[model samples]
Target: MSLPFNVQRAQDRMGIEDPMADDPGLFHLSRTERLMAFGACFVIGLALSIIGSALVFTGHLAVFAVCYSLGNVVSLLGMCFLVGFKKHLKMAMAPVRLTAFIVYIAFLALTFVSAFAFDIAALCIVFAICQYCALAWYSASYIPYGRKIIKSTCGTFAKSI
Candidate 1:
């Protein structure tokens, strides 16, 4: 007895609700907010890649290779986290941030090797200062939590666990 168009209209009306009905949380950034956050990350990555490429163009092959490799490793880790965690920022921070920091330090130290091997001390120093600053900012923003756990007791011993 009901027209198909009327039934469709009823279904559509039933689906409407307040977009902000849910409380906002770390994982609940609106689409525009998410886009802006992602854009900032992308711009930083692009700038770092460009600096690495500039090293290549200026004949610092060893430095360029080290920078390039570090970038690739970090990017790959991020991609893996995004895929496995479905973009859950907190999940990515818990383990991957520490892993990425360790990897970054290892590769950053390798840049010193390139500096010594190629005798590009000044250039490497400048690059290191910039890279460290950028990384500190990145870490602060993305991994706000530090390694902290409540105290725990095991059979006969107690410690901060």
Candidate 2:
């Protein structure tokens, strides 16, 4: 079997000699640039974590402080992991994000149910706040990095960010 003409024509027009050709663009990320971006992300995570922890000691701030603190801690750890295990962390990001979204929705359901059934309004509210903080931390950590990495790795699809 052979590839159809449209595919061949498209390839020819794009000047792609081989389907598996390595675009020089993919290799454009200098080691120094990677290091700088990663270091900035780590600093941001640490700063956010410190703020969250401070809030936790601020006279019973419902569950928001606790949630924020916990989320910030985990996010900082995740950032560290990403810096050290770049390939593995990148591979896991998509699945981890998807799973978090689904779980976030499920937690919303549970929060409502618990509020109604157990009258734990404060607790429920805190849980939701915690979830939001975690989401924010995770998003802050990866979304920027994801964009940069994807841009660098997009081969011919690469365009200005």
Candidate 3:
């Protein structure tokens, strides 16, 4: 099946090739199937995250941390369905994304440590916020000029302040 015009255009602009264009060896899936898998994983991850957030009211910090972290990880893994796992890892470890990736992973781990080991709710919250910011930064790195735009906007806001 043909891709939508916008999606095809964006893929062209980004120099992205269809994962199924070449034989992927094992676990092959058509574009539509891959999209379905990605969508399913993303929705499941979002549900887990929402459930974790709701658990916060019950004061189950450890469970919240575990669920939230797992949710984020699962969501991230969903990208592998669109791009192969090796390609995803290569892009993640690229120089542009390295810092954001490190910070994101660090915060993810720190959130768990603070919640389960240290039993520090405040610290866990702080780490969770950092993890989210890092994840956003990492995601924005994928778009053309996205990081530059964000930096410039933040700089302008800082100057105004």
Best by TM-score: 3
Give the worst 10-residue stretch by lDDT in candidate 3. 18-27
Q: What ordering of candidates by TM-score runs from best to worst?
A: 3, 1, 2
- Candidate 3 segments whose C-alpha is farther than 4 A from its true place: 1-26, 152-161
Model 3 quality (TM-score): 0.82
TM-score list, all predictions: 0.33, 0.32, 0.82
On residues 30-82, what C-alpha lDDT tens digit does candidate 3 reach at each position?
77877888899899888888898888778999999988888888888888777
Prediction-by-prediction clash tally: 0, 0, 0
* Better model by lDDT: candidate 1 vs candidate 2: 1
For residues 37-142, could you state the per-residue lDDT of candidate 2 as single tens digits?
Answer: 4567667656665665465455434443434444444544443333344443453366656565445545645555554565565666666565665455345435
Between prediction 1 and prediction 3, which has the larger TM-score?
A: 3
lDDT of 2 at 107: 60
Lowest-scoring 10 consecutive residues by lDDT in candidate 2? 18-27
How are the candidates ranked when ordered by lDDT, highest leading? 3, 1, 2
| Prediction 2 global C-alpha lDDT | 0.50
C-alpha local distance difference test of each model: 0.51, 0.50, 0.84
